[model samples]
Target: MKIAFVSYEYPPDNAIGGIATYVQQAAHLLAQRGHTVEVFTASPTRTGCEAFPGLKVHRIQPLNRTSFPQEILATFAQRHHVVNFDVIEGPDCGAEGREIRQQFPDLPFVLKLHTPSYMLAAISHIPMTRLAQARFFLGSLRRGKWPQSSPAYHYRADPEYQHALHADVLSGPSQAILHQVQTDWQLNPANFINVPLPYIPPAISLDIPLDTSTQRVTFIGRLEIRKGILDLMRAIPLVLQQYPAAKFRFVGPAWPSPQANLNMQEYLSQKLRRYAASLEFVGAVPLDRIPEYLAQTDICVFPSIWENFPLVCLESMAAGRGVVGSHAGGMAEMLDGGNAGLLIPPKQPKPLAEALLQLLQDPDRRQQLGGIARERVLTEYSLENIGQRQEASYQAAITRHQLKFTNSPSIHA
Candidate 1:
């Protein structure tokens, strides 16, 4: 099968957060499974891309100034109809879907909801101006409040909705996320599928056991509020109240927003100055070096308030650490209520702190959970498994769509 994935988000330019990770894993796995995969994405990375064997990648200049939107060149590319594909998939069917479908009306446009642009904007740096406009736009669209710009709303509002509605199926990372979106947008539940990523875990060895120390409670992610940096900070005080020996090491950039209202890195630095002796900020540690930090971590704490799925949690557990995270979005699904690792309630530091403390205080339990944590990720969320599932989904989608078209049935959304 030949599959072409369209997205504005791709690594080097901008990672679609966890979406990039999932796609890379999925595409690679599909290629390995005797399928040819091509990706059309914005080339934000300066070096074009390092290249992945068996996958044809095309990078287009961004259209909307925003990374996800396509440029005029992308518009041309979508209309060019130069490629041969048995199946086509995309991160979402928003403007890209609408514009592309204008040229290829019969193309099977699979509208994947990878947390959606609305959610991304909320997590990313939505300028107050955009925020107000977005909230108003989304609110009106949701409540049937027709704004002048109402012609343009979600991927559903794209002109292609009617043509692609039957051919298109909405997919997400987890059933939890699908349900959340169902309730959030009041979409028909029958239209969505809970197709979690069947991604293979990177073949890195985090085989080292914890050294049984509290000096490292690792935080991995772009330093931002969406990841619940503030909640994590608040829990720091609580964590110390129990395990006086505990210390924190924060990895990655401190903010997701390039345009900031308050610079989180500077803010955290100032805040950490109060506990400067106990905390370390190894700002934006290279991905290769993350294992070294995780190897030393007694526990992994993710205070993220929202996530469809967090690769960091998967990565942390893959590194064999007891993960403590908020029960929001896919974090809750990934954590599985500490069956895989701890799932703390969202927006609360108390449970998060307690979970961290529980692991920190008991080396034996931590080791047990940490060991199982890695196993669960490697077994269930492995790249091979995720890829296999994605392949199945694509095949199922193709077969289903082909049959429906052959039947010439009247399609209705």
Candidate 2:
């Protein structure tokens, strides 16, 4: 199978988020399994091709300054002239999937769901700008016949929804995400498939057990308000009130947007300055080094306000670390309803602090939960297992596309 992945971010460019990790790991795994894999990504400094056995990384430099969607289409058009891909997949976080599908009508394009704009607008309590409010209002209108330049254009003319409506297949990382999309967009239940994210553990050994004496609680995500970083900061004091030995570590970059007036850096410097000695911000640890950090962490905390499927939680579980994640989006689904680890409400300090203290105070319980978490990851989220599922989804998409185009009854239906 010749698979092509279209993402703006890829390895050696920048690890923007989970999407980069997803593309790199999935493409690598497919290549290792003897499939020809090619990654098309935007690059500022480098252009042309870098090859590694079965995998080829194409860095695309747009000839002109255009919208990201147009840039992706331009790159794809150039690449399509050289090589034909059997299956093309891109993230739903951007317009790449829909744009590609629109340009290459005959090609089989699969839109992999991340977080939809509609869901984000619904979940986020951050006071919206008038433009954002209009966007939501427009989303409530017709699904496909939206104006291009309206203020609500981005929301109403969502590329993810467009891709889902017309693509060969629409897939997401978890059932929870699929359900949310179906409910919010009023789409058919059968239109979406559950193709779980693949987890390839780092080269580092997972034999090291966390030292419980220091009680290290680690949060591995961008320090944004939506990620519950502020809530986690508030929880630290409450946690210290009970478990004095608790030390916190935040391992990622900070994202302070214009709409949200809060400054994480200032908050950390001023409000949480007294506990600065106990809290360490290992700013933006590389993806490869995450296993090293997890090895040192007794408990992994992901107090995100909302998420589709967080790769951090999966990675922590694969590293044999007990996770204390929020009961938002796919956290509870991944944790198996608190069976593997603890789940607390997001944006609440007391519950988060309580969960942290409970896990930190008991070494035996943490070890037990960690064991369960790792076992679950091995059973369900292994690369081989997910690869097989993904292959099946692709084949199904291909068959559906061929049958539908042939003027035959829809095979998927």
TM-score of each: 0.81, 0.87
Give me candidate 1's TM-score against the actual structure.
0.81
Q: In candidate 1, what are the lDDT values of residues 185-290, reduced to their tens digit?
A: 6566765766677645455545666445655788888888778887787888888877778889888886633335556777776665667677888887655677
Candidate 1 displacement at residue 189 in angstroms: 2.6
lDDT of each: 0.68, 0.78
Which candidate's TM-score is highest? 2
RMSD of 2: 5.5
Clashes of 1: 16
